[model samples]
Target: MDCIAMYIDGQWVESDSGNVTDIVNPANGRVIAQATRGTAADVDNAVAAAKRAFAPGSAWRTLTADDRAALMVKAADLIEARAEKLAVAETNSMGRVYRETRYDDVYAASGAFRYYASLVHELQGKASAENGDMMTVTVREPLGVCAVIAPWNYSMGTTAAGMAPALAAGNPVVVKPSSLAPVATAMMFEALAEAGFPAGSVNLVLGSGGEVGSALAAHPDVAKITFTGGTETGRDIIGRSATSVKRYSMELGGKSPFIMFDDADLDVAVDRLMFGIFLSQGQVCIAGSRLLVQQGVAERVLDMLKERVPKIRIGMPLDPDTEFGPMVSKRHMERVLDYIRLGVEEGARILIGGHRIAEGAFGEGYFVEPTVLVDCTQDMRVVQEEIFGPVLTVQTFADEEEAIRLANGTRYGLAGGVFTSDLGRALRVCSGVNTGIMWANAYLEDTAGMAVSPHRQSGMSVDGGLDGLLEYTVLKQINLKMTPAKSGWFAGME
Candidate 1:
């Protein structure tokens, strides 16, 4: 078996400690490869390399924006060319269905690189004409070395989300992918290398969050930290990076709301609502896990879901007919099961499926039935907290006011959706929801160049579009005297 080694300072090598972790195929519990277990020493080396490459006179620092963009485009092309291999690897390691990863994940990863590449030359500054004799101009400068920590669930796609923008802004990055799924991200760095990125400009360190992740966040040379993971872990990274006062860009946990009003097209609403909560087994940070419906139409929506949930296919990721795949691992599957138990214990009624599957074509795999909990109160733990699984809580509201209140009740505000044919109500309810991104009559409708962000505990900072590129840069102002210096005060003194 080929070992998946760490890619640091432009080379793939084994760990100095020779510590390795088994990379298991979550679909079948098979050990496919061994991954380098990076330590603090490994992190130190990667950061030092990134710092060196980002220094004033280094090759990466001297490259023009257009030249950098060309390299990024090349990397994106390479990724597109190898999309099939990358998708299969991601599905094998991350446990997402190949049907989803093959197209969505692969294309999104390549598109992110292409998106940021197009924006590299768009980093513009402002000039102020207010000062009569002085011309003031603002310049965007790279924030030097950055640490990019990506979660396991959407390994390569999320990694590219952070890596592309950081590179576009001319910042050297040291990436630490979750130990569970590091293969595809490593492949991404390889593509970058082939595209002629300067040595050490893009580095990968694979290990647990406690070891490599903490070291990278705390490193003095790292000027910024970009992370996407659970809220608790994000808080920990914040505290760890405090010593250096490093800038942070995070997309943390979310218990997003999906509301269905009485006037919404029942067919469209039901289809989208099912997809909103169940995609990627509800592992998405922006998953609409909390459903708030108007009382007049609540039962109808529940009936629709109850009939639709059973039709979803649950099997191995490689199965073309499969709609739902195994969870990331055995532990995560158990965590989700425990959350279901807690929901029942909290008085929420399980309307449909809510059990672990232990028999079938892939009995040993981590699989959970699509679950829906009804008769739920806003204060219930199942409704308020993020399950990060294929479980959703249903609640009913008497009026639009109550719906908005219930929707915004959670500590999270990452994303939400409001469905209704009444444009007036949709507009009003969308404005009332306290989320960073809101959907009207639709859910999870994403474009390439929009700024997708989180408002509350869901996270901080923008992760897409121009704002994302700006996160890796610092603004500096220059004031120039175009004419001779004024002498009124000096003349009076003379």
Candidate 2:
């Protein structure tokens, strides 16, 4: 099969060690392709190239903002043109449904580039002459050589979310996609090159997170690091980059809550609830894995779930009709299964599904039934921890206060949802929950140019809108003296 190579300095090349890792299709447990397993040496070379590209007066650094934006818009167009090819690559590599990869992931990827392109001219800084004797001007400059460590779930989407803003701010980047899903990201990089990005301005390195990811985090020349992954891994990256005092933007783990009140429209709530958790087979970082339903309507919600959960179609990722696919890998599937077992041991009841699909053709793949556990407590391990799979836990709350308490019980504060027809109650709960992003009467809606930041341990810095673009920049102030004469106080001393 095809072996995807690393894109460094605008060329595809093998790792110095010449090693490769097989890219498995999670749907059938078959190896579809191979990606070059990058090493520390390769990371160093990529960083060096990025440093050169970002240097003052270099081809990439000297380009005007309009020039950069023009190129980015072209890249976005190219990505749209190759949408199907990129989507198929992502689907085969990560087991997300082809429709999601094509319509959502690919569209979001190009949209990020286009959005940031539109904001390139907005990087202007302010000036003040309030003090007549002195004029101060503030300007933002690009940080040198940024490293983006993307997660496997939304590889192309997250990669572009980091890279597009960095590039728009005039920083060269070295991207390290999770080895589990790197093929599509590699293909997306090809579009960047074809759009006439300068050599070394955009680079891709593929390998395990432990090695290549760590290397990128600790690289001395890397001015900043943007990462989206597990909380523990994010902590490790922070520690690794600490010695250099580097800047970082982290979008870490989340166990977001989906709170449903007794007065909520049952049908609408159920549909959004399924979309919130079951989409992408529950691989989303912001997946609404915890369901906090009001006690009065708990049984009704559970009954609706019991009826609807089985109707979710699980099949091959490439099939357009498939609503769900296998987990990203066997190990991840087992981890999710173990969590289900633990929930049972901890006294939660499985209301719908809680086992692997080991029958017939599904036996060859890593498929787990979409599981929902009822009679769950706030302190249960499954409720407290992020399972990151197709499993969701249900807990009943007595009132609005209890619902808010259960929602904010977890250490994570990334995203959440509140379903209620009562505008006052919805507003109260939305304000009460400690999450960064909250949806009322809706779920999983992210508009372009909106900013989001982690509230608590979820992460740090901004991930969207004008603030995200500014994350790749450093501010400097230039002070101009109106008079070149020395002050009288110093003159007296002289």
Candidate 3:
């Protein structure tokens, strides 16, 4: 098996601890690669390199915005050229379908770099005259040594989303990808290095969250931290960053609602319903796990789900024909299974699947049936909490008010969807929900120009678009005295 190394100071190197963790293929339980497990010492070295790179007169810090953007464009091109390799690595490590990794993940990663490159000039700050005697010019400057902790599910894409903006803002970055699926992200570092970023400008460290992630969050030299993970972990990162008082952008967990009205096109609603929850086996942070259907059309929606869901192919991630794949790991599979079992114990009816596939060719892999539960209440744990798996809990709402109530009932406010042909009703629900991102007649669709700002405990700060690019920058005001003579206010004392 190939061993993935950490990229620090523009070179691929092993961990300081010299320890390695096996990277398993969730499809067949085979060890496909090994990632060097990073430690606090390794994180310190990476951060030190980043700090040096971001120093006032260093090569990285001295580059103009256009120069950095040009490098990002080259990186984007390289990423596109290496799409197949990256897609395969991602599928092997994380168990997402081949088509998704190839078409969705790879493009999303390259697109982020390209989009941020185009907006690098937007980091400009305004200048204004405060009285004729004094003028204040505000300029945006890079925050030193940004630390990005990317999660396992959408590893490469999410890492690029954070890193591209930070780099475009002229901040050197040290990224720690989740150890469970670090291979593709390590591969992406090759493109960054070849794009001619200054040494130490882009670095990668692979390990568990407890060590490498914690080190990055708490490192005094790291000026900012961008994290995408669970809510509990986000809280921990906040505490770790408190000592340094570092800036943080967190994209955390969600139990987003998919509201389907009685007048919604059943065909469209059913298709989007599946896409909203079952995409990536429902491992998405913005997965619409709560299905809130209007009472008039509840049975029809359930019937359509019953007819369509079983046909969803559960096969190896590498298979082109496979529509769905296994969980990211055995442990995660168990967690999902526990939630399914709990849903049953909570008196919810399993309308479709609720069992793990442990027989036949799937015996060695971590496979669970795509599950849908009906007769569920809003207060149940399975409905209220984020399962982070291929499970959807169904609830019926009597009217528009109830639909809005169910949508905002959860503590999370990340993303949600509203399916209604009624323009007025859609707008009302869109406004009523507490989520950061809401879609009408669409689900799981994203563009490079839009920002996703998590609300409540879902997370803090912004990700994507021009706003996200600015998150890596700090504002400084330069005041100039227009007059040749000093102010008369202090001259009276003299």
Candidate 4:
């Protein structure tokens, strides 16, 4: 196995504390690489580097928006050039399918950098004359050193999604990828340096969340923190950041609901459902894990899905026809299997694939078959919690209002869908559902348009589209001299 070094400041360095961990591929369970475990000391070095970059007269501080954008564009180009290598690295290191790395992950990751490149020019400064003789104008500046903790579900996408825009906005960042998938983040940062980001402007810190992540959040110099992970982890980060009163953004766990109404198109619902939870092995933050089908169409859809879900070809990540890949790790697989057990205990009928009792196709690596549970209820544990696996719970809702209520009832409001032929009902349901992203007549499709929002306990505001790029910015209102009028009150009093 290869030794994966940690990236800090502007160069690769061994962790100060000198702890190393072996990274296992969830696909067939092999130690693909090892990474240096980081501590507070390592986090400090990165933060200091970023702080220096953010300091006045530093290269990062003086760079023009276009200049930064150009550099990011270069980074994107380099990523594309190195696509095959990075894709394999990501798949082996993080257990994502190799094809996904080559296609969806790479596209999203590289496109984000390019997208934000052009967005640099869109940062508008506002002017207001009411403040004083000087007209006030707000300039959106970087939030300083951002401490980001990405989740295992999306090692590359989460990192690139948050990091690109944050960097494009001129914020020097310190990113901590999920220890589960640190190698992928390391690869991205390595490519970033190769792509020519200024030294200290972008840094990666690795280790456990307890050591590196929490420390970054609590770091005095770190200004803002953006994390994508479990909901409980998000809550803890929020609590930690509260002490320093630092700006924080979190894209926490989501138990997204997929609803297919009686009047909806079956083919559309099935297609959307396939992409919703099954895509990425159902390891998406917004995976439609809780599939809510209206009573009128529940049986038919379930039968269709039962036939469809199993037919999905699963194999090696690099295989061209591989439809499903392995989970991130064996530990995650165990968790998923346990949740499935819990689902059964809660009286939900397992429609397909449950036991991880060690059988054919199941080897050392953590691999569980994509499972579907029918006859589920909102009160059930499987329906409520985030399983974060290929298992989906199917529930039947009575009417539109009930569907809305059930969808909103969960603690998560990250994403949900309502499929209906009736456009009017779709619009109403979209408005009523407490989700950040809602779909009418589809699910998890059109994500390009549906900017990822961190709704309710799902965490904070969005991190996609105009809102996403804007999150990295802190506004400062400026007052310009409109007429150079004297202060009447102060002059009269004097």
Clashes of each: 0, 0, 0, 9
TM-score per candidate: 0.97, 0.98, 0.98, 0.95
Q: Which regions of candidate 2 deviate over 4 angstroms?
A: 491-494
Per-model root-mean-square deviation over C-alphas: 1.7, 1.1, 1.2, 2.1
Off by over 4 Å in 1: 129-133, 483-494
- Which is the better candidate, 3 or 4, if ranked by lDDT? 3
lDDT measured at residue 107 in model 1 versus the true structure, 0 to 100: 82
Ranking of predictions according to lDDT: 2, 3, 1, 4
Instruction: Score candidate 4 by TM-score against the native.
Output: 0.95
Clashes of 2: 0
- Among the numbered candidates, top lDDT falls to 2
Q: Residues 370-486, candidate 3: write the lDDT tens digits.
A: 999999997799998889999999999999999999999999999999999999999999999999999999998876598878999999998878888889999999998887675
Tens digits of per-residue lDDT, candidate 2, 190-275, equal 89989999989999998999899999998899999999999999999999888797998999989999999999998999999999
Clashing pairs in 1: none
What digit string (tens of lDDT, one per residue) describes model 1 on residues 1-494? 78788777888877898889888888788887779899999999998899889988999999999988999899999998888889889999989999988888888888888999999988889999687978999999999998999999988788888889999999999999999999888887778889989988999898999999999888889999999999999999999888887899999989999999898998998899889989998888888898888899888888899899999888789887888988898899999999999989999889988998888656778888899999888778898888999998999988889999998898998999998888999889888999999999889887767787788898998878898799889999999888976567755654
Please state the error at residue 189 of candidate 1 in Å: 1.4
Q: What range of 10 consecutive residues in model 2 has the weakest lDDT sum?
A: 485-494
Is 2 or 4 the stronger prediction by lDDT?
2
Report the Cα lDDT for residue 27, model 4.
77
Q: Which digits, one per residue and each the tens of the lDDT, describe model 4 over residues 254-333?
A: 89888788888898888888889888888888898888889987889988988887788887777767888888887788
